[model samples]
Target: MPDAVVVEGLSKRYGAVEAVRGVSFTVGHGEIFALLGPNGAGKTTTLEILEGFRTRDAGRVEVLGRDPGDRAEGRALRERIGLVLQDIAVEPYLTVRETIARDAGYYPSPRDVDEVIRLVGLAGQERRKVKALSGGQKRRLDLALGVIGDPSLLFLDEPTTGFDPSARRSAWQNVRDLRDAGTTIVLTTHYMDEAQALADRVAVISDGEIVAEGTPSTIGGRDIARARIRFALPDGCSVAELPVAGLPVDAVPAEAVPGDGLVTVETRKPTEALHELTGWALRHGMVLDRLTVDRPSLEDVYLRLTEHGAPEHNTRRSTR
Candidate 1:
């Protein structure tokens, strides 16, 4: 089967400003693909082209084996895909069930109304008017409308924008369920953790170009990036006094005080470094307060990749 979506050498311009420059990627069937970038990074333009909302200046594009730009096939393509944008446009007077049921009528094979309601965590609020729903609840309603069509492909933009922690987690599970059931999803969000938890693959766009594309764990070489070891320096201990394996220790200023001696060691061998540091602390009968070993998080890599003048990153394909 053809991939769910494909774009090669895509480019877009708004007068003098080039919005998207040579962006290229593919979303496989049943894959959760994430497009990530800061504001004004051309993410919106790239998505608009794929959604057939805007035209691309140069590229080959296909969505669900059809050209989204083809007006003759627009309705057919729209039937096979769902969209949940950041805006909420439901009628205020319509009840949750009413709103969802209304949209289900647009598609030929919609999911059961009640099933979609529960899927989006609005089961108990089915009878409540849209105007009465909370901000988070309304976002859930947005999701319900998007999926009621039982689309083969779904597009989610900041899907959990107004959701609280609990609601966000529930929404994540709902999205996973959709993907597991043979749905292809294209997601865009500023939440790094969301991408890390949900995306099978991710692409980072910066300054109108794709700087990196890879799995959430390995993007920007994060899997091989040095681990950070941090600890508050013992009251009397100096950086040079520590028995590290020739690893340089940098004194990081503690948040509470300007010159407080918090230190960090960046190394690839975290396990060995931790053992040696803990052993030294044990031998001296001293405590290493707030010791922590952490690898680079998705947010860390994202910030680095999007920073001005940051080096371009390479992509690594994940084995399916």
Candidate 2:
């Protein structure tokens, strides 16, 4: 599929400091791509450059297949791209429907204000003043304004930052609806779970470069990361006394479990270990209390990538 956004060898600098250096990636059509990085890692710098809010120091960038740096082209691109910033400035006196309708006027062809308000779950509250809405409601209003223009691409920066669990989940469903309708989205969030849930693929940036890029499940070699199988120890028993062999597995040595009163098996082959362990327990009539298979989550891989800083080359793969 052709990319909706493309960047290569992108660089940006602020006087003596290099904010972004040699970062490159692509967002596929109708896909949700996330950019994640620790503070000062240049995630925003990269996004700003693509948005044409800042010019790149060096490298190529294309938004909707045209150079975003071109003033005339950029003006046209703005109509196709929607931005929901972290903070929204609005007249507290304006009602929900009024706010969206005002922003809709900027586009060549805007969506119906009523439909956008409904899509954003602000149906009954349309007449309520912006100042009267809750924090979550305000965020939804921001989302409505962003999509009111019916943009082909949407930029969501921490869309659910202050939302509660219920509000956050509601926001996730709205984002999914946009994707289903074929809107390419570029998201940036500090929430690892949000990135995993929404992004078709994610890129981790650090030290002004991309350190890893792949599906949320496999980035940073997470698929091959060792899994820790844990179970509570039976009374009066030591980890050594637990079954170690005589099955189709090479058990991780007992000492590696790392804690007392609970047995942990760290293995690269969790499937086989789990099968052998369960069989042994059944034969001995033992109950494996609190058994859990733990593997590397996106958060784990993200921490590892950021802490180590960027490598010579990013481990990038095709986006699903």
Candidate 3:
């Protein structure tokens, strides 16, 4: 089957700034694709272009097998696309059911309002006015309306932005269910864990261009198995005096001092380093305490990609 969405050398620019620069990627049918970046990274601009709300300055885009910039074609293509925006402003007096029913009218064929309500876990709140719902409930109502059309492609922009932990989990479950039912979902989120949990592929955009694109585990080439290890030192032993045989000298602080009667070390190879350090401490009659190992996360990858200009691999693309 052809891709659900495809772009080639896509670019978009405003008067003084380029909002999107030569960004290209494909979303396979039924795949959950995530676009992740900090604020002002052009994620929204890229999504807006694909959604036909904005036009590209250059390049080509095919969404649902139709050119998004063509109005007639775009309207037809939109029937198969659902959009859940980050901010939803609905009439405060409208009930949840009324809100969804109103949106369902726009699509030729829409899922049953009752089913959408159930799917989003808003069964009991169906009669509640929009103004009466909590923040999380309001978000769910937005999601319910977004999917009511039974769109094959769903655009979820920060779907769970204001949700608490439990509500976020509930929203994740709904997204997973949609994917299982063969919905092609394009998501934009600042929450790394959400991307890691829901996205089959992720593209990191910064300064109007794609800086990196890959699976959440491998984006920016992060090694998931590698860990950073830090440990506190014991009393009477200078950090410098701690035998640093196997540890990288630079990994240890130059002016390491006793903190709560312990020294600390950071290492990429935690398992090997910990074993060696433990053995050395045992041999030297010292105990290693407060040891902790942490793995690099998607947040780390996002920071690395955006903190600098485009990464080395992304340098070939022109910024403007």
Candidate 4:
């Protein structure tokens, strides 16, 4: 299938500092592609370039098979694209229905105002003025306006920035609905879990470049490691004396030895480590209590990649 958006060696500079440096990626039709990164990581700049709001300094960009820089093409391109920007302000005097109706004028075909209001969970509030709504309601208004045109491609920049947990989840559902309806979504967000939940694929950018890209579960080679096993130790048992082969003793913290007889051990190979530990404990007439194993998460991978500093190469594939 053809790509919904394609970027090759895309770059943008601000006199001395480069905001985006040779970034390249593709968003397939009907796929949710997330640009995950921290503040000042060039996510917004990249989105703006694709939206035709900003010009790129170098590289090729194709949106819906047309160059976004061309004015005529850009207008046609805009009709197919819906944008929910990070910072948006609405006229305080305009009611929810009024706001959506006003935006619907820009497109040749727009969804019914009432349907759009309900789609964004603003049904009862449609009569309320923008200034009278809460923060979350305002965000919903932004979404209604963006999707009024029923765009095939949607760019959501921190779509649920200040939303509470429930509101965020609701917004996520709306995104999923769009994807289910064959809309291609390109999302930029700081929340790791949000990216992990909604994105089919993700690209992590740092220092004005993409540093890592992959599925959420295996990004940064995290799945290559084993699970961690934690349990309580019997009285008089020492971590050094624990007969767990292939387990790093250093990974067990000294503070983990509770007065009530608890020990936590982290291992790269949980199966073998658990077998050895269990056998050794039984032989020594000791019992392992509250044993549990856990896998690494996307947060772990993110910290490993961008915690210290940006890597040398612009991109690295996850070792799943």
What TM value does model 2 have?
0.90
lDDT of each residue in 1-320, candidate 2, tens digit only: 67999999999877877878898899998999999988678887787777777788899999889888888897799999998888878889999988888898899999999999888889999899999999889989989988998999998988997799988888999999999999999999999999999999999999898999999989998888888788887666677776687533545645524454567787888888888888878888888888899888899899988995542322111110
How well is each residue in 52-121 modelled by candidate 1, as lDDT tens digits? 8877899899999998888988999999999988885778999999999899999999999999998899
TM-score, one value per model: 0.91, 0.90, 0.87, 0.85
lDDT of 3 by residue, 1-320 (tens): 99999989998777767777888999999999998876777777778888888888999999989998999897788788998887766788999999999989989999999999999989898899999999889889889878999999999988997898998999999999999999999998878999999999999888878889999888887764456665666667766676677775445433444455434555566666778778888998887677766767889878888995432221111110
Give me the candidate number with maximum TM-score: 1
Candidate 4 segments whose C-alpha is farther than 4 A from its true place? 231-238, 246-264, 275-292, 308-320
Pull out the clashing pairs in model 3: 232-263, 233-262, 233-263
Question: Which stretch of 10 consecutive residues in model 3 shows the poorest summed lDDT?
Answer: 311-320
Residue-level lDDT of model 4, residues 1-320, one tens digit each, is 77999999999987777889999999999999998876677776787788887789999999999899778797788888998876576789989999899999989999899998888888899789999999888888888888999999998877897799999999999999999999999998878899889999988887888899888877787777657677886678677787644455434433365575566666676676778788888898998888777767787777776775432322211110
* Alpha-carbon deviation at 70 in model 3, angstroms: 0.7
Reference-based lDDT, each prediction: 0.86, 0.85, 0.82, 0.82
- By lDDT, is 1 or 2 better? 1
Off by over 4 Å in 1: 245-261, 309-320
Model 4 TM:
0.85
The 10-residue segment of model 1 with minimum total lDDT is 311-320
Error of 4 at 223 (Å): 2.3
Candidate 1: C-alpha lDDT: 0.86
